[model samples]
Target: MSLFNKALASIGIGSAQVDTKLEKDKVTPGGEIRGVVHIKGGNTEQKVDEIYLGLNTTYLKESNDRKINVPVVIDRFRLNEPFTIGPGETKEIPFSFVLPLDVPISIGRTKIWVSTALDIKNAVDPSDKDYLHVIPNRLMDAVLNGVEDLGFRLREADCEQAPYRLRKRLPFIQEFEFVPVMGSFRGRLDELELVFFQVSENETEIYMQVDRRARGLGGFLSEALEMDESNIRFTVTSSDIPGLRQKLETIINKYS
Candidate 1:
């Protein structure tokens, strides 16, 4: 390699480029993602130390008494040993990964994506970004449907900072807020909030919070702003799919 070519590669004028192609961008939690990483050589041979992929998203974090969005990597995967690509060379690498159950659902302002990059010494690294549309899995769909069947309307969904106790691998949790539209709890309750955590492929834990209607209008409004409270969870399995509604109703009724 000539000194001139090395200098050009260092400035990215003749450095390798990477592009990622996903077989499918829309996926559900606990689903599989398949894709291909294409690397094209520039004017000179470049050494790629490593290639990596990160499953990334953002969550609200309290900083200086204000909420700030911060990036979080839910999972990551790294490829094999160092390799060199000769001038005008082309290479294709196939990759795949299973989505983590704890990955925040792509709802509201939550955005999920896969970041791909190649680490090259003394040169600008090439990268690619592909967004993912994460949908609810079978177990999650069952719970969501169960709530709607009970005359509750989903008001909002968000990924926010998690309490120490409820947190596991991730520092945040996805919350679903609901209001009684035409149910027995309409006047008796103010709102209902839920959180889900999947411990395995066949089982999941649901956290619940029920807010009661206060005495006066002012009280109700004030209580709406304060949704924080001690939470309770129910451990349910794939076998419970048939009776999920009844079980959820039983749990919510106890609080109502």
Candidate 2:
């Protein structure tokens, strides 16, 4: 029966199971994430060659003219070196990491998660997954509030594969789409799209694409050809928080 039990364990019939418990799932960009990895040995002793964790998310990529969701790892690290656990044994390993500054905010279908897996030789490895609710940090929150205060409502947000020129540390960019609701630009603009770039704790760069509302035949032609839009790039810092709305108004009104 020992040989049969070993065979079963080798095929993961009874192997180590991994579970990760986070200190808090609600996180901010560029924040600290604390957690513990609990490993429970099953019916037989197992040798774990490696243990790793990854901060992961998905972005939309276009392939053959069709959009497909692709999983990406923002950051990953190994928990410890090789180890072993006996049958019915439990091990608790604590971990901590700072979330990347460019991690996508969990809006729409943009989900960020942590994946933990154990590498077992000649066996099916066990793994665990936990989702994270990534919220805007202080500076980002201010930018969102300022935009809303300017009378634009958020339409949608998505993490899409970025163009080569606009690619930052990651291959994806998180875009915020907004439609004018009750602002001065409500009549002058069709929609305003904002993409944050080079985000950090203190400041961030923003790329704004202002699509102007078509007026006449010339405007219609230009719009149809994607020529009626204005692109503006700027940087916002913590010191700009107090006058952010006015600054944004000044910049947006110029092109509106």
Candidate 3:
């Protein structure tokens, strides 16, 4: 028996096993996830009371000057009928569900983890977890276009704890970074970090942080801005290209 099987055997109920298989290994938000749940009976025939699927993720929380692991449940599904399995009988269950577009993408690959388990009376058997990657749709493209048009290039992207409580409903934030195109300011700004929330068909909330580097004489200057359920993501426009270029010269004249 495998280590997992041994662990399950130690629980004292008849040994049970669970397996999960997904139809599409990759998907985008607003996509559907379809899979099968396989269950095997143990030494004795058992009354399989129920089965369930959990969409879970690990998030970070900061308090007391430190961060801690926090598990969040995005959604859950349960079987309504009780089935009986003969000794050593194998059973398969089918499942499919649509993923919410706003769901946070995993650290790397929008791939979220889905865990499935079975219940035999009070005994529980958990299957090995599966990872499914998600993609962002057209809405994401529209948002990115605005940023790129504003002289920012994609630098870094990741899911992290929201820095503030301004948006209470979202558990994770995606940060995108961009550098000022050549000759944009007095000194080159490091990069801009962006966060999006309340994403939908019509509008999305945007949060921006500008990282301005300090030079010889001037105090460091930086600004943070937030937008709630609005599409005002771009402040500088194409028409401002000429004036924006001039502003960079002044920055150099003043400092460097």
Candidate 4:
């Protein structure tokens, strides 16, 4: 059964229906979101105190308990109060809100739901939840472009379930995995993982881990293998986006 029907059945208001509409299907970070909520009274007269619109994001929590159902509030709106409508009364309320600039997105594609609800005190009703995919902003896109330009292909992406500290307050952290082009990395590295930590308004720290390939030598050949690898920490911090890409390429060349 539909959420509308379930809510109606739960509240004994088999006559009311709710619908929500959005101006755009996709919203950019730090952009405007505009939408309208529609509510119709069912077979009988009903008293509605107010209607509300909420922008929410939900994710799963992984811990000792390992349970799901995590919802965070992004924005909210309230409609008129103490409205009385006879049988079959239809009402539409318009709402607009600003998306926060620092709202975090999952590493890859992620679906987010926005809810618009009509609250008739003591009435059975369900809030409408609409799904949208959150895409990365230009700053992040630039970084990805730089990485690809350096001949690194995306391998995988994921988010950390535990709270990780970054310079920013965003509760989630995203990791991008990549494999360097042939002859780019030396020693026996199989893959490289790049994790971005936004430390401040203008600074980002790119943390990297190299997974080394197994060695056949007897005396820790991998540890003994010494190639002049350009330190990425120094390179990325001193360079612009393009400069960072160049530095990364240089590091890969030197390591290879």
TM-score of each: 0.92, 0.97, 0.69, 0.67
Q: Which of the two candidates, 1 or 4, achieves a greater lDDT against the reference?
A: 1
TM-score of structure candidate 1: 0.92
RMSD of 1: 2.6
How far residue 168's Cα lies from its native spot in candidate 2, in Å, is: 1.7
Q: Mind giving the per-residue lDDT tens digits that candidate 4 earns over 1-256?
A: 4566546644766656779888886765666778787877776666776777666664456767775646666566776676765667887778787766545554464446677766666666557788755565555566677767766678877654435443345445456777767444534465666666544334556666555554567424654663222224432332365476666665554544
Kindly report which residue stretches of model 4 are placed more than 4 angstroms away from their true locations once superposed.
1-13, 65-71, 74-82, 106-109, 167-170, 181-183, 186-244, 247-256
Worst 10 residues of 2 by lDDT: 1-10
Per-residue lDDT tens digits for candidate 3, residues 19-48, read 889998677666789988888877655566
lDDT of 1 by residue, 1-256 (tens): 5789889999888889899999999998889999999999988989999999999999998999999999999999996689999988999999999998898888899999999999999998988999999988888888899899888999999889999988888999999999999877678777889999988768889899987777678766756776423357789888999999899888888866
Candidate 3: which pairs clash? 28-135, 186-251
List pairs with backbone clashes in candidate 4. 15-42
Give candidate 1 regions above 4 Å deviation: 216-230
Best by TM-score: 2
lDDT of 2: 0.92
Pairs in steric clash, model 2: none
